[model samples]
Target: MSMNDDDAEILAVARAGFLDEAQEMLRQFEQGLLVLEEDPSDSESLNAAFRAAHTIKGTAGMFGCDAVVSFTHEAETLLEALRSGSRQLDEDVVAALLESRDQIELLLGEVQSGEEDPGVKASSEALAARLRALLGATAAAAHAPAATAPSQAPATGALGEPEDGGGDGCWHLSLRFGHEALRNGLDPLAFLRYLATLGETRALRCQTEAIPNLDELDAEACYLGFELRFDSKAKREDIERVFEFALEDSDVQIFEPGTAPAAFEELATRRCGEDPKARAALFQCWHEMGMRFKVRLEVAAVTAAETEAETPQAIPHIERRVGPAEEGKTQKRSDRRSGEGERREGGRDRRAGDETRFVRVRADKLDKLIDLIGELVIAGSGAQMMAHQEASPLLVEATQRVMDLVQETRDGTLALRMVPIGETFGRFQRVVRDVSKQLGKEVDLVVTGGDTELDKSMVDSIADPLMHLVRNSMDHGLETQEGRIAAGKPPMGRLALNAYHDAGAVVIEVSDDGRGLARERILAKAVERGLIAEGQVLPDHEVWQLIFHAGFSTAEQVTDLSGRGVGMDVVKRNIEALRGSIALSSEVGRGTLTQIRLPLTLAMIDGFLTMVGGVNYVLPLSAVAECIDVPAECAAQNERISGTFDLRGEVLPWLDLARFYGISPDTSRRRSVVVVRDGQTRVGLIVDRLMGEHQTVIKPLSAIFQHLKALAGSTILGSGDVALLLDVSGLLNAAIRNGQQIRQTGTAAFAHAVLKS
Candidate 1:
């Protein structure tokens, strides 16, 4: 059968949705497995893990991802055993399951890429063998029949043999499919075929009483129901899981082997509603079906009618059935139904509330929305700028109100992109587990402030850098069990990931309680690599930073992880590219904490605009401490590109933007210093004018300007002038290094002359 264009498109969309949902399920599965590994008695985690695998297998089957379905089925079977207490969880089982989880992910990836690798298939088979081994002989034997049989094969058990495991294993199921089942791509017959694979279908009956006449029939609407006797060893939950996808709109009832006849009578009444003719027709259908329970139907129906007459308030206009012995049971069922109705109503209300609270939107759509909002901010600024020039108070006021609303809108839209860092943090659990075992170390990962939120884009990009840091800590920073024990510390090492908002940036710290950086070893490596002079003396902070240089390491030997010295430099570059900074603090015999500070967002920011030497510049409003006039002493040294200024009792370094960027100064305007804080240090920026606050939409600099470290990006002003956005941290570091160079050689005169030119 060939699919048309519309059908193909719908299938593609559904497959994409499935892939996304499968990824989340994988995460949950890994998390549950990790929890169970710590405490095997955690039944909740075991069940959750089983369900995650079961869901993946079921949904993958629907899409015909045969590799994923086959691989996940193995894991699902093992999980089912653990869930049912048929097999006890052990370390070996947990390890195999974790590996199985990874294999399933690879299989799903193949499904997503629409390509298959023979190697993955080979690996899947090997892992499946391991999972089966974990299930032991009895479980493996129990699952062998279903595993080897064709999925749609009919059951072969004899219907007349009561001793052939049909007595207590027989389950009666009633199914009423929703009207839109056909449109939703669900076929009732397919479910029945799937059921046949589970066990023997002793008997089957189809009810067509709801089918309308041909003239009034809708081909797309389903008007069918099924009653069947199924004999299977599967639990009720397992049976229900078969119809999980359809349960949203379909009504499925499962009765155990010993269920009373009155229960069926009640089911018939509920299915038929309050119409007598409909009830009678349904009764006739049941009698004709010749199910196992038909022998007691007449007596049960009469007794139900009498019970209904005695208790008329239970169901209006419906004659009850069941005798005095079953009367109490019937009333209890009615009460249970009422309670269930209330709970269902409450569930609907809660779901409705959740629908209003959260919405799943595509990333591209959100990016487009943020882009439009950026343009609106620019347009609003332009309007406000023009209004002030018109010299009309009313026009200015209206424009100001519009700008305020635009600002609010911008903030709210950006907030939509803010996601908690916890999900990203949670991924490292598995990494830590696997790496620690490989490195022969005992490491505990402690995460704090996971609820802290940051831009979703940053969250995604930061994961790799964080991964490297974690691996580096586990492989290099944390000591092995023997080393730790000999060093008067506990055999177990501690690695912590912490995040918090400070000033206007998010700071993530990865700290490890292990042997800190070896200052002498790092210096020796730096000297050996010609990075610095052999005899040079530097502060601890500067010495620690030498490790970030490309291909710099103090390890005596190279290993599979970290010692190759390829990751730290890349980590630094990635963070710097995000307009962020990294700092390290370490103490001998204690630990090392690597801190990364990043901007809250990249698309837009609240900026303090300024102008120097006819060129406009913007500073992040969060980093701006205060604006003050340049002191007379500092102003006198106009030729100096960098100098110091005194504010109250403290002295802070100041950078002259005009001289620093080689722009001609506007001497006619009085210069002011914008005090900005970068970490613990404060730096003052000398500018010609303080232009107050502006909403800055950041546009990245072209490749030609990539070497310019002081300018983070550029933006357009309301007056249509191009303004450069300053990188405060980078600019301050550059100024300090330049000042140090001049001081080293005592070449103040040459430096001043060079600046003046």
Candidate 2:
């Protein structure tokens, strides 16, 4: 039957949920398989692999995703055999399972993206055949060892059935359809049809005493019930799940053949509303299934008012006050009730643990929330400003407290968007394994400090850049095994991805123990491309930076991995777009390390506000070292030196924001220098005024301002003035570049004149 609109919507939601769960299952399977390849005897990993496959298959079956179900079922069978000790986990088996995992991922992706290509079906079938062959070979090998055993008498049942035979396990399921079952679109026969796929239905009995008189009968109402003996190796939960859609309005009682008499008596008591004939039918079915009835189970139904009136813990309290003659019975009853309570509580805890506590919020939603909070911060600043202007101590105090609370809320809200970078790092494991094997190289990927957290948006944005770096390292930095041995290095290559929080920013480092960048080759390539002047002398770091130039590569032979001069420039641009920086360092025969530094969060930051040439600006609080008044002599000689300052005997390079941005300086204002550090490079920013600390909300600048370099973004202040936030790393680079220009000209006047122009 076709689904109604509401049903279709429900099914869509269910499909999305299934896709999410299936993706997680795929990840689990991938990780577990990788682990199993290293240590095949790991029981936990084996169980995890098997469970992931089985769950994917079962859930796909429920969703009617036949392709996924069919393919995963065979893969699950092989995994089960491996898990059960029937099949050994060799490299071949691990490889096959890994392939199966990838196929499952492909199928799920196709389903999620709603793509219907003919090739997917062929691919799925091919994978299924591969899995079947594995399963068949495993089964043959398992039985071969038992074939030479001594002959023994066949064990037989009373009815001449093989006692320990296959497909003999049976579960008796009792289902009574509610009146609303048919109206709610639940067909008991459909469930039965699906059940048959699981196993055989050895026996079936239909209960029909609820049928109304001919004139009173409602045609749409359901009156049928079922008692069936289902033969399958499926667990009770698995069998019960077939009727999931019907369980809300129907009665379902699943019991094994050897269930205690009390269980049956309890079911009978709960069936008090059923017709006498129906009850007798249920009892007869139970008797046929070997249930023996002895003691009567009487359970009094509590009224809504009574249940509400009594406290949950009061019953035990009242039992404790019972007379001595009735104490024993009361104590036993209380103890049993307590035990049941414990079981129920334990079940609830398990459910709680299994249930996902975190919701997957859309990026836009988080951005909107941050935007609203940013507005609130601006409004709070305005209020504080007004309170100060009004000269009211009480008002100022109240506004201060409110602002404090708002700041806390801002922090908590921003923290919600922080996620660990490990998820991004984990994805490279497969890439490393596949690429290394394809290249015939022995490489080990070691990840450390993966728990470092960064803004979720940044993490997502940085993954591609990180991927490029890793692939570049593997393709270029790492040498082949034979080449490694010739260089007196270990035969195996080592690639590491590490992240940590440093100076209020997340630092991610990708390093490899391989042939470092060839300095002469890079310089020669730059010279050939006219990227640098011929015979120009440059520092090793500057030469390395040339690799980020567009269409720059030193590789003589282009390969599939990374030649045709792509990726590195994109990586630099991507990192720059996030207001972050990347630095390259290498030692010729040892290795290369690419380090990226990104803000802890893109939303808001603690900023040290300052003013230059009457324009307000902010420096990241994390990067700010100290603020000091400019020396009288230095201020007088500012135009002479242009960039360098003697700060307590250190020749620190400085940038005058007023001169750099071409804003006329307000000489009447007292000048100050704010020392900021970016990695090992420290620079001083000359400002007209030190405006103290402020909580700054970072609103990204327009694309036009991207080339401005010094202004990272802008924010609003207490007086509603738009303050430009300084890009610390960019400012540092500009200062260094200006200093280099001064050195090249042998005069600060040329640099100062260029800035003025």
Candidate 3:
């Protein structure tokens, strides 16, 4: 493919447009396929698939990629057959169509990989053979039609993906074919066909903007710029890659009717330069992004006619918009350009690597990043150790600077992985809809405060527990239609899923309006089952906590809606495993609210480094309350685990840290007890000294010690020794539950032989 400079540039530009359209069309194909699966009878889905396939044919034809156009034409013909009922929409037809879709993707991939024309023909021929057999079963052959196919489509609902996000946040791309494109064996318009895959091109404007007179126009050169709105899945990269090869010589620009970034103006201003080579490169980046480098004079007029079209007042004003003839520029570009308009091929995972561009790294990779960070922490401790051994101030200062740099790098990496929780919440709407239908109930799920983000892994696991909670609410927490009507409430129930940042933790609430829990009944059942005592006095949340006990359900009869005594206990276990807490609160006739609180991140966290005897320990700062000197009377009861310590008349349970870890304290008098609360269960942890806040990188303990319940995880101290991270929630639960369990276990274990009925 020896293209003359002019033909090469022209072909390159046109190829860009072609690919954009192709991408838009393919997006439609994917979505249409999904829609068809959701609603097989939906005439809309059928028409959508037909239209997308049809559009691909027209665009592919323009590029002279006879193979692509020709095969796509056959597919369109078969889809029309299905639409007209000549060929049934059956397993065979859909399976063939799916295979055809895969073939199209393979063809595009072959071209992208620069494989020979031989590979392309083989694939295209295979697809064409499949499609050829499926075509010819059109409307006339079916002989039964209700609505006639419209002669022409009322321009596809504005170009680019089918989202009705108002305002003109849409785009139009124009790619021109330069002269000599055909002579070089390159089709000047192949890229334009590719663009059709992206979305529907609402309008295809063949620009003669630079076309010379008939005699002056070279036959081998391309001189057309197409204006198109590619409507499809929003893949920005494929469109840019079509002309990626023509960065140095061709003219190209894309326009977006969307909010412009603040830096646009400054960038546009600095873009005024005389270096043609640099200008070309810079312009290529700016142009492909569809960023408006200069404010359009027409914007004011257009906006006046319709407020919807107004460009923001802050838009950058380029001295003059870069046009086809203007030379491009060069300079260091920002990280946002990595996949500016490119799509990942073959479903390969992408990560924020060492490259400057923004990318999404997997959690394991980030954990590796955190692991490297831990090694850095250990290395820092080693340096401090070395400095102390040498006892030199200069060594200490140099080590200090390196530690500071490491701290900054760690913070930066962690920040990169932190994502808002809102994205996770959005998928629940579909979940609620499907679950409600399954349970044969009419429920509307309302969500709020979705912008709160968390660690990506936390977001991933939370979905399951949240799903179980929502399902419980639907099946058991909410009332039936007849039950609701009798109570003077709306027949339709309301379930709300909300998430927000609270204190240093993420608070997620799944609440429902229905009949509240039967507290007296649960208590009676617990006593009879021997899970509780005959007469136990507890708060509402404590009673609710009993619901999370294994095989505990108060439902009278079991059905599919729940009550086989599973799920809630599992939800509790999962939340606890993540170092989070779940609590329940309810009003008799109002509703039930299940709230789960989570740590901001499972990675490195801020901790308060403290010591009891000779061992150093890290306490999660999120759980820290005020530390105070234990009074003489309170300190005297260090051996009694159930005794309450009085602080301003508040009776907080006391647990000596020394005794809990099975280590002896240096001194018992004039010691401090740090009081921490888990829900309403307050306990004081007795320690010898309190250390200020330290950056704690958590390291999990081995499984052998995991059941110890007193220790959560471990971390490294500045002295290069390991210290345990306390399980604040677990220790609190054990302090209360274990005390109750002890009294029952002593009496019941030896006495059960004579009590069995």
Best by lDDT: 1
Query: Tens digits of per-residue lDDT for model 2 on 1-757?
Result: 4547767776676688789888888888988988888888788988898778877876676666777877776777787778767778887788788888888888888888888668877988887777667777746344221123332343332223342211224556767888987666566676776566556676788878678999999987899877776655555555665665454456677764333333444455556444433344455565555332323212235444553343231111111122454445433433322213353356446656756676656568888998999999999999999999999999999999999999999999998998899989998988898899888899999999888988988999999999999999999999999999999999999999999988898899999999998999998999999988989987776788899999998888898898989888999989988989999999998999999999998889999998877788999999998888876645765664354556787666666678767788778967888888887667667789898999999988888887775678999998989999999877755644655433533234323322322
RMSD of 2: 9.5
C-alpha lDDT of all candidate models, in order: 0.79, 0.74, 0.64
Least accurate 10 contiguous residues by lDDT in model 2: 313-322
Looking at candidate 3, what is the lDDT of residue 88?
67
Instruction: Give the better candidate number (1 or 3) by TM-score.
Output: 1
lDDT of 1 by residue, 456-491 (tens): 999999999999999988888899899999999999
Show model 3 residue runs off by greater than 4 Å.
Answer: 1-357, 381-402, 533-538, 668-670, 679-681, 740-757
Clashing pairs in 2: none
Candidate 1 ranges beyond 4 A from true positions = 1-7, 141-169, 182-197, 200-209, 213-215, 258-261, 272-293, 296-350, 737-757
> What's the TM-score of each model vs. the native?
0.87, 0.81, 0.57
* Candidate order, lDDT descending: 1, 2, 3
Top TM-score model: 1
CA error at residue 120 for candidate 2, angstroms: 1.5
